[model samples]
Target: MSAPTATAPVGQTDTDASAPRRPRRKLLFIGIVVAVLLAGAASYVLVLGPDAAADEAVPVVEEGAVIEVGTLTTNLAGTPAQYARVGVALVLSADADQSEVTARFPLVKDAAIAEIGRHAAASLQGEEGLEPLRRGLTERIQAVYPDGEVVRIALTELLVQ
Candidate 1:
């Protein structure tokens, strides 16, 4: 008869069985660590995002205001016939100081005169044309002074030959 096979100790079986589970335990530990890190990153972004944005924002100016200029005369249709005469009054706005309006007067004048000449001659065709010219002039004036608004463009006098 053969000798009885050697038997492992009873408690040693449990140790042998647990050996294969070690890799799974390590993976679970890594997953938990990753999850914790992600949570911490999310919390940090949520808490400090607005503060960081605020730091980059520009400051507000409270004392800013606007100024308007009255009527100015300029040659129409690039001619001095004295027949195609037009008058334009601009209502412009400025910051707290009126210098901004004064400084931009030349630009304003050129733009207004050119626009009026272009629209006025055609607009003299009929009463309906006059409304369109008024609207066009107002819009043109506003475009010239985008930062400073044009409240109105009063056609004090419009004559075209």
Candidate 2:
């Protein structure tokens, strides 16, 4: 029935308009703080140079000179029917005497095989046993080359069958 009232009925105000602006202000402040923190880090690195302690703590050592002593297959001490074949590799220093180490390869192989033959299957299964074996091999190899050419010895391939 009646003709419509053409005007707004009333007392509502635009209160929510400023509510959305408050959140945008908070976000802008947070972004500025983050940017400042990142800029500070960049400037620190650029002005003071790289952190020497971090650089010294973990100096990446390059594998310079390397030698692969051939694989050795020998029966273990106590465990019969179980044989171990270890492929050995040695990392040498840049100043290492390659000729001297090459000349003593036989002794190194013999020492490694004999040391490996002393341990049983159980003793050589995990790190506990592997550590001593590695130490033994290192000592034996280093004994042959007192110049300390051999930096590290790795059993690249180890299989017990």
Candidate 3:
């Protein structure tokens, strides 16, 4: 009689079948990572878009205060035949109070009166002569406050003697 031969169990081999499944699991892990990155990027863009647009639409304003000016009077230097006496109502701007304008009133008044007396004709016959004088006086008032401007100059009373 021959000795009994040794045999292996069914469906059991020395090589592993789970080796192929490892590659498929790695591919699934990479896909999940890429999907998470894309979702994070999309969320950031949607959140900040409106705030960026609104910031551009707003405007900035300057800060300061406004002051009202009253009328000033001064004498014109010249003979009665050569010059006409003028009275003007002017509106000006200043950062200081009425007291400051009052202190500088004499200087501003004199400058305006002198300019008008020198440039204007003694007898203004028509609109041509009057228009030039009005513009000239307005410019003179502006000189007093270089930073400020004159809004209006009205010849309330004008007398030639």
Listed in order, each prediction's TM-score against the native is 0.42, 0.58, 0.43
Local distance difference test, candidate 2: 0.81
Q: What is candidate 1's TM-score against the reference? A: 0.42
Cα lDDT of model 1 by residue, 45-97, tens digit: 89877477677685543433444444545444445553445566655433323
C-alpha RMSD (angstroms) for model 3 = 17.8
Q: Which candidate order results from sorting by lDDT in descending order?
A: 2, 1, 3
User: Mind giving the per-residue lDDT tens digits that candidate 2 earns over 1-161?
Assistant: 99985553366345643346777899999999999999998898897777855876874544557899989999988857888998887888767878877888998898888888887878888788788878888787777777767876887877877
lDDT of 1: 0.63
Q: Which number leads on lDDT?
A: 2
For candidate 3, what is the total of clashing residue pairs?
0
Q: What are the lDDT figures for the candidates, one per model?
A: 0.63, 0.81, 0.59
Candidate 1 ranges beyond 4 A from true positions: 1-83, 93-97, 120-122, 125-127
Q: Cα deviation in Å at residue 134, candidate 3? A: 1.5
lDDT comparison, 2 vs 3, better candidate: 2
